[model samples]
Target: MGKQLGFYYNSNYCIGCQACETACKNKNKLPVGIHWRQVDHFETKNENNDRQVDRYISRSCMHCKQPACAAVCPVKAFRKRPEDGIVVQDREKCIGCRACVHACPYKAVAFSNQAVKASKCDLCIDELRQGEEPACVRGCPLQVLKAGDLREMEVKGVVKECQGFLKAATGPSIRFAPEKR
Candidate 1:
């Protein structure tokens, strides 16, 4: 790909308000029960400190560098944009085989039971083209979400993977900032 655009998420500042999730649904007009983006919550209380801890992992398609979805799609319905490296799905070409759904480690490829097709994030391609940020990024009230060049978004010393997310061989294009205190 020419340039890989990806997301930067700071779990520390994410309050799990789900505004990002709502914005994504509203912007994409997705089928009912199909979420292009979702927030996963993790909570705990420090045993010694007794301090409550909550972290929200707001995520969607990783838009992997080597997408297993693309490799396994029977109808060649998926393509990574050469210019920006955003993974895209051609719904018309989909066969409802669910192969992509099975192959994605991130659980990003959602099968729409209503539509009998697979759907995932396209990085808000149209909005990006219009020079607007993705709805999820813009919807975050705490400014915890951002999208940009993968390399540029990476934190200098923080781990790319989070509690529930892994750094797969697919080379997921997401970066995570250290959780804020």
Candidate 2:
């Protein structure tokens, strides 16, 4: 693992306990009502089996292949690493116009009301540099979150589910394997 990038979420294994969510908030030191990561649950009934099954979705920054947030940032706050495609923000340069928030289709970009700037998942580059995984992925009890190379993960048959700007422009590097319910 030489500075690789991307996120892999196995919905089949996720418990929707929000450990990832809390971990992200704590690691980032976000104030109340600020979320860099979140868990979403969708429930559906199987007509054939007369059973109800719930699908849990873990969502955050996709750190896309072609990020709209970076493109729309007037101050050039958003950046993507050419080697790994990890999109990040330079807080010092950010003017907090909320342009990135509007440009992002995934709604992944979060504007800090106090800091007066936008923040989102950077895939925890600092942690990776320290030879550690992102806080959320590490804190997950169910071991559902995996971060690494998109090419390698796809080759391993990790099915990806994309939404919003990601579906249109592939703005994030997050992949998901939905559980069959």
Candidate 3:
């Protein structure tokens, strides 16, 4: 891959509005029951146990370096692009076997009954090629989402993991700025 493309989310700034999810669905023309992006809200007690805290997380395909979906697909429908390292699907080659759906550790892959194929976030490659941000990133009212080179985000001290997310051993491309208590 020429560059490691990825996204970043700051939980501290998220308002749990689901605007990113809505933007993703609208931009991709997703059918009912298929959500490429989702927002999760959870509550936790502070360390002092005096008050409860709410956290909002926006989640999508991480486009991992060692993508389990790509590894498990028998037909090789999933591929990591050499230009930017975005994991994308070749729908014409897919068999609708659901192997990718099961293999993704972040549960990013989804089965589309209408199309009879596995689908997930491709990070809006078309938009990126046009020098535009992904729909989800652009749609965040709170500016909680960002897209850029993974190395750059790491250099800015983005967190690699947080609650309600899979471990980073698969080398997930997304980074988190988790809420601090």
Candidate 4:
């Protein structure tokens, strides 16, 4: 699982409850309006059924193969770990320049108005080191999120991008379970 650890979200089954978001906040103790992960919901026409369906999206840092956040950070505060390909932020090095926030194509990086630093999902590296799944994966009531080797997950018929998510040049590390009819 060391080549590229990434996240897979099955949007078809997600209920948009923000349980993952809450769990992340609880685990990271993030201040108000600072989100390491976020949920977005919308209504779309189900082409198969010709009826409207609610679509819920849960996303965090893509931990991209070529992360723009890391590229744009003047302090080099963002880096992708060589062992697992998890993009990590060195907060101590951050200067709150917000370049990463603007450069990230996935919009994964977050700037805290309170702390004035940039932060994003690190995929709960401490938990991974202890052999536990990320807090968001553990916290989802519907069990829609999974994290592991990116290559292995790609073999499971996942798509590189979900609705409303663009395929950027950064090669986002996230995949999505195919939508169900």
Candidate 5:
């Protein structure tokens, strides 16, 4: 939409804390098993130095440039706003088909068992509409989650490529910057 919708996560600052996850759940009123955001851990060993290093990857909907969730949705519940490029779902229009769930490469989309409909982070649109940060970003203790323009944030070393195929498939708008040694 306004070139102002996106997120940047710096693993260096993330600390594997689940604060973001918890905040999203609380703000959305989601149950225990549902996670709008999840953290991934990557570990590597340096044989020469005899050291083990771990990297934390915090992931959620990238709200792609071309979201598969919107593409496969049968009822057109998922929509991508052209103004700021934000993807959102209309709860009233959803049919609980789960097609979007299968289409999402990052598995960022999920079907809510309680609601019997597909659900994912709407990037806290309600808060953003009021000029506030998403709940998860605001609640992150380490400030790992950030939302703003991708171009501007990238310059601050807070953005990076998408983790895998989702990067190529939808060109996810959000970026990540892992911690440095």
Candidate 6:
């Protein structure tokens, strides 16, 4: 409920390199198939029928103002941090119920086979505390990813909805700069 930290992605600048995914996994020491951050590819024909246009989206937990995952957790394992508004799951309190996984609209929550818990991105709270950007943001080869205060990014004309994203009443924190036509 404090500063709402969020991500901004410029689709025009992304190349679907998956570096962000790699960096997130390495930084969090996540097991295989448990991706806290992921790159998604989309292809569509242009309006003029010239050729296929490919787009890539880097996505993770958006740290929504009303996190459905937190609401559905029977054990109250998920919490939105008061200081930075980062949604985090307390592994110890998680019951592996998968309710959170089902509740999250972005499909960001994943069950970790190694840890036997539901896990999602915490926005690298520790790194943020150190005044460092999240690994995904720092590792992007194209520099397409950015993280900061959501309000500031919005003021700069970044939008919350894009080609692969839908508007959520929860007020997801991430923003997008759509690819140019």
> What's the lDDT for all of these models?
0.88, 0.80, 0.88, 0.88, 0.79, 0.89
Q: Write the per-residue lDDT of candidate 4 for residues 2-90, one digit (tens) a residue.
A: 59988888988998999999999999998888888889888888877788898988888988989999888888998899988989999
The clash number for model 3 is 0
Candidate 2, residues 11-119, lDDT tens digits: the string is 7767789999999999989888888898888766654778766667778888877799988999899888877788888889989899999998778888888888888
Better of 1 and 3 by TM-score: 3
Q: How high is each candidate's TM-score?
A: 0.93, 0.89, 0.94, 0.95, 0.88, 0.95
Candidate 6 accuracy as lDDT: 0.89
lDDT of 1 by residue, 51-122 (tens): 878878998999899999999998999999888999999999998999999999889999988788999999
Question: Can you write out model 5's per-residue Cα lDDT over 45-136, one digit (the tens) per residue?
Answer: 54465887766777788888889999999899999887777888888898888999999887888787778888888888899899999998
C-alpha lDDT of residue 161 in model 6:
84
lDDT: worst 10-residue window of model 5: 157-166
Name model 3 segments beyond 4 Å from true.
none
* Candidate 2 weakest ten by summed lDDT: 162-171
Error of 2 at 91 (Å): 0.9
* lDDT, candidate 5, at 21: 83
* Deviation in Å, model 6, residue 54 alpha carbon: 0.9
TM-score of 2: 0.89
Q: Quote model 5's TM-score.
A: 0.88
**Candidate 2 runs further than 4 Å off:** 1-4, 47-49, 162-166
Candidate 5, clashing residue pairs?
1-83, 1-84, 1-85, 2-83, 2-84, 160-176
Candidate 6 ranges with C-alpha deviation above 4 Å: none
